[model samples]
Target: MNMDLTHVLDVAQLTDVGKKRDHNEDSVASDVSSGLLVLADGMGGYQAGEVASKMAVLTIMAEMKERLAGSSSGKIDVASGMQMESTLLRDAVAKANAGIYHASRTQPQCAGMGTTLVVALFTNDRVLVGHVGDSRMYRLRGDAFCQITLDHSLLQEQIRAGLITPEQARFSNHRNLVTRALGVDSVVELELHEHDVEAGDIYLMCSDGLSDLVEDDDIYLALRTLNANLTFAARHLVEMANDNGGYDNISVILARPRQPYSAGRHWRHRILGWLK
Candidate 1:
């Protein structure tokens, strides 16, 4: 199955610090060769958070480029593209953690700073996701949507153990507290997930700033309402969160998957696919 991807891939991203916060401490990076899109929301004392977030993004991207570029791993057959991507993504995150830890040790100002990471890697027929902390990845398929990754957070742990009801966790004082993140220690734990991808599927990578304030249903509506224009959708989505009471820094990335085959097919067929 040599699935050809759309020649033109479009991605949209937007970030805003809520009304209460002055600075947006989240950062995003896209590595097309490995098909990775990373989002990190930093948390720590004072300005250390922003420093950690920036370092995490840069470190991951740099490591990925260093490892994948001019390396034998990327020289594999097209048939093994999926496996190559998987390995690269895993290695990149580990390298990022190491770099963040090293930086924390070298700089007293950023010592102990940490950040949550959510990364999505797209392949010909699927998308692979890796995450730690509370940032999230979402997929929209046809008329339905689902969260393809889990949150490694204190609130989620409590909810899972039945120690706190979902409602309580939503408004809990410890809701923003995360259980896992990079740069806090020498090593970090990560979660990786995968899903079948299709043309017309829409993907969203965001931090807790957006997810905490905006509900899933609202996201679905926004995508439908925006007609999938990159700039319009990204800005409006951020604006929605800001209007809803900007409590924290908001970040968003919206991407729509297109099929190579569809480009040469009958225009009406493509239109009918949506109607169906």
Candidate 2:
């Protein structure tokens, strides 16, 4: 994708151990220059969860960065109607999964460690969201807030099969029992979705720790109140989750579009203008 046609991103991220968790098992990474955001929520024994989450984030970031360096040509390759950006996003996730899975198998300490993942890559006119397990991506366009990624958990399957209602699934014991996760096996499937982005649109990528405890309406209110300040909005979301009996580690990433990329504009000036 042509960098000149894309929107500059304003990003803020925060992670917390939460009120009840003894250790944080979540990891987050953001590459503002490339408009990349990643979040992972891990599960395992002792410190393995933290290790797995970090590995997933680092692997994805490094792989994506390396591949994106060659994509400056701004040529969009199409395959079965999927854009080049989408293909790149998919390949990046697959590469991360391979690295994580290999480590889990070879390292005894990392045995059984797996993590939920959510990744957002912003191109010139669209954002590609790729996810596995239950970590999510939400978008706030104007006054409307909606979840853009679906969870790959048993509760979600049950809800889809009409075995339970949305209200019942909320209180279900299988909320955290994800049917898909990275590093759990040699390969994993990721659900990818694309959305057109606007200059005023705000995207939120978070772990289940925050979503499990906080109501969507409350989260929307928080975003609406502090949308103008990404840092404050991110910190407030973590605080709110802890206040509402944070039963797990919480992580949040906020990204907002600042301005469309213009070749004639100096990059430094544009960044300074957004910070102002």
lDDT, each prediction:
0.76, 0.85
Candidate 1 residue-wise lDDT, 158-253, digit = tens: 889999987788788887888899887777877876777677888889898788888788988887777468669778778888888878899988
> Every model's Cα RMSD, please?
6.1, 4.1
TM-score of each: 0.84, 0.90
14, model 1: CA deviation in Å? 1.5
lDDT for model 2: 0.85
Pairs clashing within candidate 1:
16-250
What TM-score would you give candidate 1 relative to the actual structure? 0.84
Where does candidate 1 stray beyond 4 Å? 1-6, 32-34, 70-82, 260-276
Measured by TM-score, the strongest candidate is 2
Separate clash counts for every candidate: 1, 0
Tens-digit lDDT string for candidate 2 (82-136): 6666777788788878887887888899888989999988775578889999999
